[model samples]
Target: MDLSTVTATLASKSYDKVADICDNLMLQVATDGIGYHDDWPYAIHLLSHFYVNDINSARFLWKSIPSSIKENKPEVTAVWRIGQKLWLRDYAGVHEAIRGFDWSQELQGFVAAFSELYTKEMFQLLLSAYSTISIADAALFLGMNEDDATSYVQQQGWTVDSASRMLTVKKQPVVTEQKLDPSKLQRLTEYVFHLEH
Candidate 1:
């Protein structure tokens, strides 16, 4: 599929067709050294849209998610399951999957700042589920020693104990009363979760 067609399909929420087109686009970009900017590889990672509504289909499509993105972001994994729910038009399943997720604060912040900069709603959709990993998992994901991850999280104002407990978890439901600057927001969401790409 052509890039224009693929973009148009994604614009219309033709997610399955967009996925197929993206798969081909990635291969073409990889093999031919052509099309898109340097971030093309990262762009391809966005296509995985597995839906729990179609258990069999979800299982099949889940395999398409690239390892790099999957290892770093559990929300992406969850969102694919949401996509499966979207596929089957199972409103209840989608609700169940996204229950307890709160997008209000992040969405408000993003809309106040970045909504105009981005055309796609994917990041806005993802605002709720983004969270910092456990220190051990963060260490593993970052290929760092436990000490490093501890220091990093500490630097970000999180407290961790050697007993493997996150003593000061911040990704909980409460939004801070103070509004964050864009840099602080970037650190809190992007760096905290190692989703810097």
Candidate 2:
């Protein structure tokens, strides 16, 4: 397991690549089938799981980590706290855990990247799920101050009705691809053959 490569990947903020490297290296070199060895870059590996919004994978990784290692490394546990909060969809708690932890210099960038990605996904979800939402609720869901959330929604083209204090979401049109049905295609071909004959 090359710790330096994982460190470099973290600095690059390519979490998917980091995850692939970590998982592949763990499988090849990890002793005793534990998938983790001494000096493993577990924090980033764990964060990489969440970065892809794979909560189940993150939970599995947490379960695989040995109790002794987690006990010794407070950073691992602290980072896992963010995952737990995310599993429960506790946005406030997620932000709190991220801000509350004293992340190492190496991890600060990765954590910041995760925060930005998560916020973006949450904002999209809000836009799709709501026609109108209160600024206070948006702030809570986005982990932003009310004023910032107001400005952010406005920038996204959501109309702000000052008297109502509700941000009307500018929902993007859903464009579903039209998948051709095989049976219909077969019938059309048969009809065409008959007509030609």
- TM-score for every candidate vs. truth? 0.31, 0.82
Per-residue lDDT, model 2, residue 27, is 74
Clashes of each: 4, 0
Candidate 1 residue lDDT tens string, 1-197: 24676646645544445456655776786698674442332322332223102345445546655676667655555555545655675544544545423434322232222212221222222223344445655554333456875675566555666565543544436666986689888778967678646
Q: After superposition, how far is residue 150 of candidate 2 from its true place, in Å?
A: 0.8
Question: Looking at candidate 1, what is the lDDT of residue 106?
Answer: 20
Candidate 1 lDDT score relative to the true structure: 0.47
- How do the residues 1-197 of candidate 2 rate in per-residue lDDT, one tens digit apiece? 34677877776778768777777777767554654445787788898888877778778888988888899999899889999999888987888889899999988988898888888988998987999999999998888899999998899999999998899999888899999999999999999999999
| Predicted structure with the largest TM-score when compared to the true one | 2
Best lDDT goes to which candidate? 2
Could you tell me which 10 consecutive residues in candidate 1 have the lowest summed lDDT?
Answer: 111-120
Candidate 2 clash total?
0
